[model samples]
Target: MRKAGWNPIWKWLAIIAMIFLLAPLAIALLNGPGGSSGLYPSPNAYETISNASRSITRLPFDYDTSDDVEMLKEYVESNREALSEIDKALTQQSRVPLDYTVPLDELLNASGTVRLPMRLLIVQARVAELEENPGAAADVYAKMSVLSPKLATGGLLVHVMIASAYETMALEKLIELTPRLSAVEKKRVLSVLTTNARKPIDFDLVRERESDYCKHEHGTVRGSILLWSGSALVDQQVDRAIETDDELLRLRDEAIDLLGS
Candidate 1:
């Protein structure tokens, strides 16, 4: 069921976002270099894109290790042409609606696997912010949001991304800059989080199944991260910031409360 403020346009945005986050992973998993016949076309291109994405996603975390960085650099350097081709393919794919329906068992098994890329991107964006490239970091996050338009309510990944972005972006610079901006801008930034604070997503009983995919050891990490990050972001940043700014406190509280009622 759709939420009250659910925008139809966002549904399209969500599909594009999903393609950006998943197409490569899909390709890689289905048709790696040694992959035989697979469901999707263009296995070679997909494999290249997948390898590069994995490297890029892991790059931020393993930055302190020289060997890891070198391997990533080599992968990127060798795959430049393949990367460009796949990037174009993804952009083209984004224009079309994704057909998410699959055999039930397949969908359930794939759900846990599908979320890994988004998690990687979230970490990538956070690391980008830490590196002081807020623009690039925001771009990474914008892609993440575009992929999950229902992010506000659909699942754990969105919640974590929102909280991490808010804490990293909001507490660091956005809060400081808030005093200088107009009321409207402040409201807009705060409003981005309102959906997630309320309207939690229904994952179609995926969370309740006794299958391996539903287990915490395998499946629930995405949602767990979301719960932890969102709670922490709200507690540390939103709650703390309002302590110093009465006007902001009111606005933030109202945004969250309105969503609940």
Candidate 2:
């Protein structure tokens, strides 16, 4: 018997395999590079904030108790310079450009460093209240309201979650403080609340940035494939985050109305 010629079906199978293999590459090419668009504000404030966060003194004590108030006062006073830098960083118009392409440890370190400052802000606010400085306390809460959103701006989902927590803390403080604030301070605080409620976290941008980081870290073709496969899960997460944010905003609106009243 003559040797069988190469099978036509085998040829067609090889062609299909090639198409399947090249599909990702074609998709990646069309999509272009991953990572941040570099449109973020210049002179990134991340380093300043991170450095300040590290320098803050951490005191382990119940913030609620009057006994800890003195310690909290000392903590704030001790970290005065650091807190000042942080305040400047947060208040500046510049963006906190978080380099998402960094290693996981580095990213975690960056995210972790910020919490101390946040905690310190709470302490400072408490001290302000204890000192009968409602205006000062109001300022602290307002700063927190501003700072909370900044924490997640241009950051990943982790940052978004952290920001949400910060915002929650700020909102809670606002609710408690609104009754005590002077009319002028209440109006100012109300303005901040309105601004934050109007512009909730941009989960879609977070998703896009995260997708870009994945593509950058794990070659475009593989990353695109991974992101595409995981898109549904990511979207679900985004939806949940948006819902949570909406509820937070609703609570904020109620607070605004109460303050306005």
Candidate 3:
């Protein structure tokens, strides 16, 4: 069964009941759930992060007014349900298993001989959002069954896309990371994750993650793990990046700058 609190609505319902059960209680709810509680991550942090995500997507050239936008709108909007699930999973969490037929990695790598340029546009939106939104990144990260390697492929753009996603992690997580990850990667993850850790982190969850995950160590150990574990994923990414040519690389770099700023 889905955990009871997985429904964020449950909290709202509690507030509404207070309106009738006790008028004074209703006024307290109006102050906001986490206003005095301090459980909420800052509203401004989210605003800044979302701003970074949008900046990455802003383009110098006009976006094609084509069917691809419609398709992309459909794809990401479709993920809205999943995004809500992400919110729940990150905060309250749940035990109920979702019935997913296809894997996210499979979906991420899903491409055919005839991919339209519009598809790349769609991918950039999803990827950028996933990179900037740690909760969403958690959802995807949960679904990543295993790791491979990074340095194998000579492509730089793939490296940056992967790097951008890592940047969203909160601070302490970044500091705890291993050395295999380049300084570029470590900072990126820290930048994303730092603000969220100002208060506290669920150490229990951190403990459950493999010690070798870049988030665990300080230097050499972390780098080795990332360099080794990320090989296959990196190869896939770098190869695809190289295929996109210089223009896509330019866009990807611009997007990264926006994500960080």
Order the candidates by TM-score, highest first — what do you get?
2, 1, 3
* Reference-based lDDT, residue 250, model 2: 76
lDDT of 1 by residue, 1-261 (tens): 966875789988999999889966664454332211114433332233334444443334453233443454454455455335434433322111112333445543433332434445445445554555555444444343333322212223323334333334333333333444445544454455542332223333212221222222332444344435555654554334334334333444543343223
Cα lDDT, all candidates: 0.39, 0.75, 0.32
> Candidate 3: misplaced stretches above 4 Å?
1-67, 92-195, 198-261
Q: Which segments of candidate 2 are over 4 A away from where they belong? A: 1-7, 31-35, 61-66, 131-134, 191-198
Error of 1 at 116 (Å): 3.3
Model 1, which residues run further than 4 Å from truth?
1-104, 150-261
RMSD of 3: 23.0
RMSD of each: 20.8, 3.5, 23.0
Candidate 2 local lDDT, 117-155, one digit each (tens): 778888888898888887788778777767776767777
Q: Candidate 3 residues 154-243, lDDT tens each?
A: 112322344223332211222222233444553453343333222112222322221222222323334445556876875675455444
Q: How accurate is candidate 3 locally (lDDT)?
A: 0.32
Count of steric clashes across candidates, in order: 1, 0, 28
State every prediction's TM-score relative to the real structure. Answer: 0.29, 0.83, 0.21
Candidate 3: lDDT of 11? 80
